[model samples]
Target: MRDRGLDVLLVTDPANIYYLSGYDAYSFYVPQILAVTHDRDQPVWIGREQDLTCARETTWLDREHVLLYSDDYVDSELHPMEFVVDRLDEWELADGTIGVELDADYYTARAHQAFTAALPTGAAVEDATKLVNYCRMVKSEAEIEYHQRAAAISERAMEVGIETIGPGVRKCDAAAAVHEALYSGADGTGGDYPAIVPLMPAGEGTGSPHLTWTDEEYEAGEPVILELAGVVNRYHSPLTRTMFLGEPPAEAERAAAVIIDGLEAALDAVEPGVTAESVERAWREEIAGTTVEKESRIGYSTGIGYPPSWVEGSVSIRPGDETELRPNMVFHMIPGVWFDDYGIEISESFRVTEDGAEVLADVPRELIVKE
Candidate 1:
């Protein structure tokens, strides 16, 4: 807090709260904040009264450090930030500049307005967006271990997804099998729910990457894209692959080759002291003459995610990004390309090592053709 000149930091991002206090629950659907003050050794955990037991059980916070507001503050005229303002007054933490995650997913405008308006006179509110996320860019050994376990589950789930998807199989049924494999985990390690649902875009929908599956059955000679992640203890390892039920189109095969080659080139470029954009440049150079062209960023930092996204919101691997690649930083190098009717996505989740990139999953890095 001193480094940023923040007297108190009001953290609302669930993943960041989990990182700081080990406080985990579905309670992020409502108002909750972790208060980091300059004087306190532990960050204060503030939430609804109903989740008090959840905070006690999940967090290492002392009883006094974990505070809860009355039920009247939820979804009513009385906002939870008003209670937060009262606590700040009681603790005398509102006398200086306060930092808030202004751009967090769950930090609503109403909450911001309430909190800022209720603060004491002369107390400044500054934007500390992604501050905690940047702190999480580099993973520790334990965190890396969790990511490796998640990668194992990802490989298993992807195998199930590919095997279950066929000409006559329903897309929902295939998604179910993939989910089972993800939750069941591999090598006796249990899995956690991923930040994103299975993205199974098939046939013409393959051109759009973010489309989810429906009850529709698979058709012959069509491409299906499976984008999924395996989460272990909230850490995520995302994986994407393209499959064909029968004989695949020649264009798709060619694109797959280009993507795989470019992905390898990008992975090979990962090392300490290298800029993130350097890796992207390698991929672009490898596919310069190919018909497949990608405009979106290929990959991003991944770990310790919550609902809606697995990206860590730091260090994107793309052109013009100058973030330095440090050892132990993990990234999902996904170089996917889409055409008018079909798309190909073959990705790898890797960790930057002192030597080079350490690919996490053991899945075959190629297009899978099933007859």
Candidate 2:
């Protein structure tokens, strides 16, 4: 807040709200805001009146700091910003220059307009979405531990996918196995829901990055791309790999090699003080002579997230992004390449240390093939 010249900050992003105050409930489909001021040690968690019970049970905040607007305010023309304005007045922060997350997923245009108009006349609303995300870039020791746990779950989940997926196997059955492994956690440690569902873009659809599965049966000689995350306490370690039901073509095998090499190159460039784009540039340079090429970003920051997505959205490992790396920063580097017929993706979630990057898992890097 001080760096952004914000006397008070109004955070509407559910991820940020959970990060700041531990207010965990899927209550963000409606409007919610976490208020932070220079004067208070604990930020106030505000949301729909019905969600207050969840906030009380989940958050670390005292009930006095958990404010709620009436349920009547929702699903009506009435905006919850009016109650936020009331709280600002009650807390004596009504006239302060407040920073709001204008770019956040939950902070809609209507909400922004409604809240901005209700603030006191002298007060200002500034775009500070990046501010919180930037602060969240570097992981603490505890956060890294959670990530390691999530990584463990991710490895087991990948194994389940590989075991259950084959020619004539129903894609839904494979997806079900994956979900079991994901939420079952590892070593008796229970897991949480990942920000994204199992993305198993298969056969001709392998080239598409975000396609979900259907009831179609797997076919021989077809490639299946598995992009999944293992979540622990909301921390994610997303992992991806390609599997083939039969002997993959020589070209497909070569593309997998290129993907792995490029990903390693990017990971090697992820030490402290390096630029984000430099990582992508390294991957591109590594694959220059190869037939594989990708125009999309290879990676982004990851950790501490909610439904809708797990990408922290602060930084990206791609061209034109100049965000510098620092120790304890985590990233999921995916040097995936897509051809007209298929795609090959092998990714790693690593942490930036002072010396080098620490790859989070020991999973096999090559495309798995089964006859």
Candidate 3:
């Protein structure tokens, strides 16, 4: 906080809150903040009275540090930030620049307006967007172990997805089996709910990236894209693969080969002291004259995800991102492309080693033909 000239930091992002305080719950639908300041050795946890037990059970803060407002503040005119501002004033920690997560998914505009308006004369609010997220770019040994376990779950879930999806099978049924496999986990490790649902776009719908499964039956000679993540203790290892129930079209096979080649080239480029965009450049160079072309970024930093996304919102692997690769940093390298009527997705979740990249999952890298 001192480095950024911030006297106080209001941590409102749930993932960031979890990162800081080890407080995890589904109570983020309402207003809450983990206040960090130079005045206190421990961060103060403030939230609704109903979630007091959640804070006490999940966080390491003392009883006095976990404060709660009355039930009237829940979805009423009272507003929780007003209570938060009052507490900050009472603690005498609000008399300087306060850092807030302005772009956080759960920090609403109304909350910000109330917070800023209620601040004391000497206090000011500044955008600290992604400040905590940047701190999470590199994984510790324990965090890396969780990601490795998650990758094992990912491999099992993907295997189930491939085996269950075929001609005459319902897409929803296949998705159910995949979900079961994900939750059941692998290597005796239980899984947590992933940030995203399974993305099983089929045939013509493959052109779109985020489509989920439908109840429709799978057809022969059609391609299906499975993009899923296995989670362990909120850490994710995402994997994507393309499959065909029958003999795939020649164009589809060719596109899949190009994607595989480019993905390998990108993974081979990962090492310490290299720029994020340089790895992407290697992929682009490998597929320069190929019919397959990709405009989106191929990978991003990922770990400790909450609902809606697994990306850490820090470093991105694409052109113009100058963040250098470092040992223990993890990334999900997904090289996917969508065409007019079909798409191909092949991905690997890897950690940057001192020498090169260490791929997390042990899965086949080609489009599976299941005839």
Candidate 4:
């Protein structure tokens, strides 16, 4: 952004494109750079003609520069370096320091190197994606509306998944059930991430969190862990719930209670001015003596895309994340527990509000039992 002291920002990441412009098509074959400045007149875009149509329809780009490439471009036969140079020369952008995202894809890096080499003497290539990501941390009004609808679809799919969990149901079948439910309820687009795929580890598979679905039959008293999400218009809501095919063992029941308690504790910590570290600590405090092993962060910000709210710039969840919990910020809390052959888990979506936070999904968090 121009306010961040950069004259122009070159965005190569797909998610970044979706964040800035509402362009979410899969056109990686064609290179794209979004030039942004505080002055609307100076803002521009560089991409292929097909992509330009989508950008023009949903976005507010001041100008767009299209490039034509041959089949050799894909196989590394022809490079697009010269094409960008002529455009820069025509735009008279040979003076200001140019900033490119550090995390550009390999193809984007090649194009960036070409641009730098071809530019006039004074132009400099700098990294400015951190600033762009910081801007994306906070959700806009339209972004929140997309996420709310996604969460609603995810909740309905989850409910359908819970109800379909009887004997003789294959893990993949259950995952399929969830997919169908969400797709029917949604506006006909795959979510930001894979939706309705139950990583159900039944019987011995329950011990590993990374286990995928199989044709394994549901047995009496066997714990079935269902991890799934529903994709609604390219947005996602992740959730995981465990239930008994018949009646779970007493030990599993106790673990479920502990996991639910931990989940609630983490959810309670999600208020304005709260730190990511503090949120994770709340879950640990609840499961202090429990046998479960915690792995990832307790939760993350959610918007149009899953994992869209990354800590942005740093790995440690420390103060540099001055990501103040502004109202309208959305988050997905996945507080889980790993206990021997069975895992206990709970998940939900929430939006930060003035008073506190609003729960977007109405799905019940109680231990779901399918008879």
TM-score of 1: 0.98
Q: Which stretches of candidate 1 lie over 4 Å from their true place?
A: none
Query: Which candidate, 1 or 2, has the higher TM-score?
Result: 1
lDDT of 1 by residue, 1-371 (tens): 67889989999999999999999898899999999987888999999999998998999999999999999989898899989989889988776888999999999999998888888898888899899999999999999999999999999999999889999899999999999999999999989998899899999898888999999999998999999999999999999999998988888888899999999999988899999999999999999999989999999999999988998998999999999999999999888888898888999999999879999999998899977
RMSD of 2: 1.3
Question: What lDDT does model 3 reach?
Answer: 0.92
Runs in model 4 deviating more than 4 A are: 2-4, 38-43, 49-53, 56-72, 80-82, 104-123, 186-222, 306-322, 339-342
Clashes counted in candidate 1 amount to: 0
Better of 3 and 4 by TM-score: 3
Where does model 3 exceed 4 Å of error? none
In model 4, residue pairs whose N, Cα or C atoms come closer than 3 Å (at least 3 residues apart or on different chains), thus clashing, are: none
lDDT of 4 by residue, 1-371 (tens): 45555666667665566666656565655676666644455345556655666666656554433334444444463455555556556656656666777774534666766667778888777787655555665666776777777776777777888887678877678767877777676545444444224467776676665676777667776777776665554555566777777777777777778777887887677677776677677777888897555776656665444232322332222223345576776667766666666676677767777666777777778777666
Distance from true position, residue 317, model 4, in Å? 7.0
Q: Residues 1-371, candidate 2, lDDT per residue (tens digit)?
A: 78668888989877888888888777789998899988888998888887878998889999889888888789877799878888888877788877888889988899878887888788777888868888899989999999999999999999999999999999999999999999888978778988889899989899888899999899998999999999987899999989988999999988888888888888877789999999999999999988997888999999988878889989998899999999999999887788988888899999998988999877998899966
Name the TM-score of candidate 3. 0.98
Q: Per-residue alpha-carbon lDDT of model 3 for 83-107, expressed as tens digits?
A: 9889888878667788999999999
